[model samples]
Target: MAAGLVELAGVGLEVERPVRTRILHPIWLTIPEGARVSLVGPSGAGKTTLASIVGALQPASEGEYLFRGERVDLLDAKARAGFRADNVGFVFQNAHLIDERSALQNVALGIIDPTVEADEVTGRCLAALQQVGLAEVADRKAALLSGGERQRVAIARALVKGPRLVIADEPTGALDQTNGKAVLELLFSLDATLLLVTHDLAAAELADQVVTIVDGTLA
Candidate 1:
């Protein structure tokens, strides 16, 4: 197999103490650069957990996770944070916008580089919103936008960082069918590598690879 942009080998998650719980079973998978991979499973399955692991949001309990040949699971907390900030952008089920902030400000949150000039950040954020077809609403408060518009704002936020990987967890779950389809199309159009976690089988069809998990193991 080709070396993966993201790789997992025998990775598993377990909780100990009052009660023992195994959230994910040891499994192996390799995703090449620019691959569009979708993960689908039953409600309680470990799909989101796996996405979190690969996105560097959480560390695997065992086995190794590598991103672009670096063993990310072994990185210290600060290093991991830096790695995620620099390379991973995540879109969740909810827009998760700060209601008080304008669409531009919400997207600007993705600009983690403190040294970037304020004007430059605003310029980049405006461009990102425009890319997602939301430039007209750049100054609108997130609270005033419709659900679909808000999600677009979230997408612009994710893309503003110019991440190497985009981790989307049920990104279209909250939208109507039309909005969901639109959101999925926009997400797939991005040039970055994609790892999508969704319950929608149709969404999986858009990916180059579909992985199904059942009871914490690949099914």
Candidate 2:
């Protein structure tokens, strides 16, 4: 596959104690670099679960999963956290911003450097915020911004780390149609190897490929 950015083989997920639902099928798929993918299904399906697995937010239950040639299931918690910070960016339905922090500070959090000067961090943060069309709100607290504006700030924060993979879980759920569309457009524009979980079929269309899950099995 020549280092396809994401690849999955015989991927399956199940819960032991509850035995309530199957979360995944023995599905196999590969997504190359700069490609966009959507995992779409009704509620209770494994869309979000699959996204979590791909982004290394959670480990897989069975089979092989890889990102950038590294076996995700093999990574320890500490290593997984580092891998996610350095290579994966995630946007969720909520921005998950620190209400007390300014947009600039939130963006700066993505760049963790003890030796870097405050001005340097501020400058980089400003640039990233500008890239997401939020320069004007750089000094504003996330609590004060509108939903759309806050989502943009989240995007800026995700990009500040320059991650190769962007994983968004229902990122547009809080928006009106117009705002949702705008938020999604901004997300796709980043051109990272995208793996998204969304219920919006139109949003799924943004991806180069789509995988549908039904009753916890890829359909």
Candidate 3:
């Protein structure tokens, strides 16, 4: 059977104020396996909004979204939660780790495996951290890490799930030149298909396709 990784057909969204203004138009895009695609546009150009739809975090106002060929544009709240847990991982502009937990614990939260033992989870988390060259800091609390270190931990968390597709939102927005490159390297290292939202033209060049969004439309 053919794998239908992600498909957005005639998707449209609108953010209305009390005046009912239309903010976003329909977007049509597709992502096949192992394809690294970057969505680029200026702020408020609906880039993040589009990513949210693909991640199944937001329902489409008018369109169809298929993940692995399953219709997901209209799932209810609970079903969307389950669908995301099984098929997707998101790395936002911020690390979003729990400050109270250790670095390894934060990564384990990505999987939420009920069957996996605590020690086993730690092992997998540690392994992922090591892959990001963060093994030595695995036991430290998330609050104590530097911004760059925290982002690496976030990257490790996203990879630990072994998701089919990884969606990153400005994965390097908070890092300096050196740290941004480090985080970017770790993100692309995953064999999974990558759909990243970045303003960096340089990073976008590495993608199989560079989709530029302008004024809520693809240019």
**Candidate No. with top TM-score:** 1
Instruction: List ranges where model 2 is wrong by over 4 Å.
Output: 1-3, 19-21, 112-117
What are the models' TM-scores? 0.97, 0.92, 0.93
In order, the Cα lDDT scores of the candidates are: 0.93, 0.85, 0.86
Across 103-128, the per-residue lDDT of candidate 3 in tens digits comes to 99899988766998888888889998
Error of 1 at 41 (Å): 0.5
**Superior by TM-score: candidate 1 or candidate 3:** 1
Superposed on all Cα atoms, the candidates' RMSDs to the truth, in angstroms, are 1.2, 1.9, 1.9
Off by over 4 Å in 3: 1-4
Clash number for each model: 0, 0, 0
RMSD of 2: 1.9
Worst 10 residues of 1 by lDDT: 1-10
Error of 2 at 165 (Å): 0.7
Q: Candidate 1's error at 49, in angstroms?
A: 0.6
Q: Which rank order by TM-score, best down to worst?
A: 1, 3, 2
Candidate number with the higher lDDT (2 or 3): 3
